[model samples]
Target: MGKATGFLEYEREVPGELDPLKRINAWKEFAIPLEEEKLTIQGARCMDCGTPFCHVGRLISGMASGCPIHNLIPEWNDLVYRGSWKEALKRLHKTNNFPEFTGRVCPAPCEGACTVGKSGSPVTIKNIEKAIVDRGFQEGWITPTMPTAHTGKKVAIVGSGPAGLACADQLNKAGHDVTVYERADRIGGLLIYGIPNMKLDKGTVQRRVDLLAAEGITFITKQEIGKDITTEALRSQFDAVVLCGGATKPRDLNIEGRELNGIHQAMEFLTRSTQSLLDSELEDGKYLSVKDKDVIVIGGGDTGTDCVATAIRLECKSVIQLEIMPQLPLSRQPGNPWPEWPKVMKTDYGQQEATKLYGTDPRRYLTASKCFIGDANGNVEAIRTVEVEWSKNPQGGLIPVEIPGSEKVIPANMVLLALGFTGPEGGMLEQLGIERDERSNVKSELDHYTTNVPGVFAAGDMRRGQSLVVWAIHEGRKAAREVDCYLMGSTEL
Candidate 1:
């Protein structure tokens, strides 16, 4: 440890963010970086616990307890505290392929399992990580590196999300040729489109993409395996094929007037907005406009929060987020103990912006939309909602029961369904002849990512269902190791 008593002497601190109301006026990252000295103080807060659980990366009670990619947190913290930033960056990149992405958007399960957090505040691990990588970029420490030797084995990956990129990077480092195919016009599937620029700037995603391209990984955008090229053709050409296409099928509300105009999936709205912003700085007018419109966003998750922020940026007249689940406690409950992800309340950037603009939190908990009410022109005009209470059903499972006489109507000009995804889209899986599990995810063992078909593998959301980007990176790395072994009967990944 850099300083044995540092944890006792220092308190946790993070970088400041732009004022929510002011930041909403433009689509750019709002987090202000902490100075090197302040970040060093934050790094000194890492405890000298002999058994550090921050990198355990295990699931406890169906939630991530630590870093899924098993980041070396304590080592980097020590290095940062000692002012050895270059060394700290090396330790960070040893495990995480994209610290910039995770540092910006990861929920930081590592901090939840942080040993220091058991007693007081957790170390500012996330901010320190971002600082190290961002510094590495500024100092030109990160650049293209050619492999020492080529194994002459070519691999094809059918996605350009975190999982696919991680897999390509690992394979390329192992002296194998790697090609990544993306269905979208841009390289990053989720990072570039599904997430708005306010949360994670598109330039950050593109910078990493360009670096990977310079390192010999081929990127083919606007090419889908099942559509533009057949799965069989891809398999025949490549020595191995790994599927990292994410679970992108948005869950739909099957209520009356769902087919009405002015209602859209959250991804559709986000993707179009990001594409337009990048193409013309939003001058293209290709995205759905919500200006001066009362927007109702259903579903209470990260995606829902993103919708709220995006609507605010577009200058919506009013916005509200409806979550059927009851509000989480301000502190951890009895069921959620130390080292597990705290099921406590958190005010994300989007919610903060809404609060600043509207003078109140825009979230309405324990409320569920009953149906969409439309005007004669077939446009959604309002939403019928009812309050719900969760109770144990006959099967001893929790279920939301609607309360009588709790129905109400809320005016809405646009409705965005931010409900989570069910599973990966079926078209590509069907084309590849891959078997699906009961939950419709690709059938593959956890550590061994190989599917039933020879030379074919699956990883990330396509195999594990919807999950965090860090987990996707872990899956991609594991799958790459397995693919390397399958091809050469051994691996050093």
Candidate 2:
């Protein structure tokens, strides 16, 4: 709304990324932010649409369409266009607790649902968002807003991931004494360990964690609720307990030669690599090395992309990604139209890096791994794959059917299973006796987020299964409101 003809005047522009070949040499964030003047032009591209779909957080065809946290996209864009970054940062922080994290790592569904994207490119909302928050941090506008009064009610959050962090932030704002427990050696469960440093810098994660600590929120690391401390003890100590332990039980590939040595779960590999890099810069030999080896990553998703990027950094001789499903169309198909999450092929940063180095995209669509072929030492040496065709099963569902005479073997010294997670690990749930849904996720009502137990609540990946960081923040905020109501009789979160 800053300029009526802004969309007509300005073409969509986004932040530039470092050269693929140059960026692959180190573990650092590669995206170079746009200057203020260019970002103003990008912000002007936010049209004055009567119904801005970019801010309407909803599910279209079972996929997210807009900002999951329902960020005030248009308002911030207008502010950014008019050179009111302080006001823009205020609006950005109103909903999302961690804009920096989401701005960097989130797959922007907001752009997919952008009103401007119907004909031409969408507004660079993601880059603009990053700019606002980054400026807030640089100009020293962001600070710890400690609560004026404590409610005398203590709440325990069992996770240091996005969900738990958001919940604790909101609850602390509501004057409740919030304490977070993380099982990992450091805070920021997946943020610090699971994500590669190249994507979301660990320093950024620590900065936010430190800010939360300064806000009077207590964070206890290396302490698990069900293991080191009993659930009964936690319940006795705190008035309410919110479980945000992410869905960590990774899905496995149960095939021939499943017990091979070089096959590792994506989280295990990513976690170790990050930990080693932080500890000794990979010189301690703590993480599994894939240097000078042919790497094969199974399952085509974000994690798979991360694995490919990690392998490239490790100086792997070659890399390939195996995906069971066929590749999506380059653009939206006939059945898929506007306002829905586009089902199209997206070459992520890692794939782009691999393509730059190997002269081909690492992903292999419509392929299924049959079995692992190992050497005499029992380490994975090669993998047998079969081209698959999608056919209608009797149950009226499409399933992968292996094509006859399409079997082939590919050299692979290391195989990383980037398959998605199943659900939360059962140890904590079992100890807490929380109910689980059909998907093995902690059973909690969508809006209420209340578990079967009266004082216990669940949110984020634990309740909703594996999801984006933006959704995790939304869940955390919603759950915090519900927990506040339960504790104080009436809530004002």
Candidate 3:
């Protein structure tokens, strides 16, 4: 809630992004920074509605409607509108430890639930949040603060992803001796590897990692709990354990020519690209660069979008994204009510780049891959695909059927399977003997993060399956609270 009459006086606006053609030449964030004065006006656009559904953070009709972390959106918006930069930063850090990441990538369901969005475009909540945090860091307001006194309890966190990082930050704040275990060579799990650096600067990830290192949280990189360090040793050494390994098993395309040389999983491609960027020598003959190659990304979700952007930056000859679902409408449908998140089609940075370059959207909706056409050298040369339609069967579940004579082969020397992820890898879970849900995710009580094993808790994607970074943060905080309670026998979280 910023200004009572501000909604009527001003319209919503966001920062301009870099030119698509120019931005595609390099791996850098495309979104232009909003000026401070403009941010104040954007904050003023907050409607101050009687019911602030923006931060509800609940499930309604099987879809997320608000900020899952229950961020103090209205309070921060009002503070920003009043030009209270420090106050806004303070309110932002209360619920979100890392606003910079969420600001960049979060879908901002809060905006959808905003009262202003009902009538017009909503306030630039995500941009304002990013601006506040960035200003805080620039002004040296964000520094690591070690706990006043250590509780003498040790907590072992498995995974350095968002949830694990949040859990470590909160647990450290609560005076627990926390040790984070990561299998990767560095901290900031997917934030470092899975996400391309152009969208999120690795330097930003390193900055947070350094801050946490200074805050007395011990990070043991290249040390896997189940493999490098035995789970038994961790449980014996630490009073409590929090599992945040994340859902990392990439969903594979099991169709024909699945083992083709040129075809790679989205995570693999992203990982190689990030590693190459991190270490120039790592790019030595093995890395997958789309330079001078025709790139085809399968799946139209965020992962596929990321592939498109990455491929463009790699100077690929062409990039095409195929989605099995039909294209979305431009605006909200009648069925999508005010409180529910709207399913609408819009241009993201990658598609915008593809449009600017190729003169059309990179996505082809309602498309399905039949097989990979490989060259004599065993490398993929093209993709055989056809259009698909979904219909309800006699039972109730919808089934996808391929249309006759719709088959076509598209040129592609490189293909990235951006289909998505399965549950978390089974190494740690099996080593600890934790029970998995039917979907292979760590099964825990709805609100509780505790696994069947005593003194062990799982959260984030590992427990809930693939999800957004904001949800991972929420899961981490909640799991930390539960771990704190399990250790102290009180609701102190």
State the C-alpha lDDT per candidate: 0.93, 0.93, 0.90
Q: Write candidate 3's Cα lDDT for 311-335 as tens digits.
A: 8877899999999999989999998
Q: Per-residue lDDT of 1-493 in model 1, one digit per residue for the tens? A: 6567888998788889998878999999999999999988888888789999999899999999999999999999999999999999999999999999999999999999998898889998889889999999999999988888899999999999999999999999999999999999999989999889988999999999999999999999998889999988898999999999999888999998899999999999999988999999889899889999999999999999999999998889999999999999999888889999999999999899999999999999999888999999999999999999999999999999999999999999999999999999977789878999998889997689989888999999999999998999999999999999988899999
10 residues in a row with least lDDT, candidate 2: 1-10
Q: What digit string (tens of lDDT, one per residue) describes model 2 on residues 1-493?
A: 5567888898888788999999999999999989999999888888989899998888889899999899999999999999999999999999899999999999899999999898889999998898999999999999988898889999999999999999999999999999999999889988888789999999999999999999999999899878899999999999999999999999999999989999999999999999999999999989889999999999899999999999999999999999998889999887889899889988999999999999999999999999999889998899999999999999999999999999999999999999999999987789888999999999987699999988999989999989988899999999999999999999988
In model 3, the runs with Cα more than 4 Å from the true position are 281-286
> Model 2 residue 51 lDDT?
90
Task: Give residue 356's lDDT in candidate 3 (0 to 100).
Answer: 97
Alpha-carbon RMSD of each model:
0.8, 0.8, 1.2
Cα shift from native, residue 355, model 3 (Å): 1.5
lDDT of 1 at 314: 87
Task: Tell me each candidate's TM-score.
Answer: 0.99, 0.99, 0.98
Order of quality (TM-score): 1, 2, 3
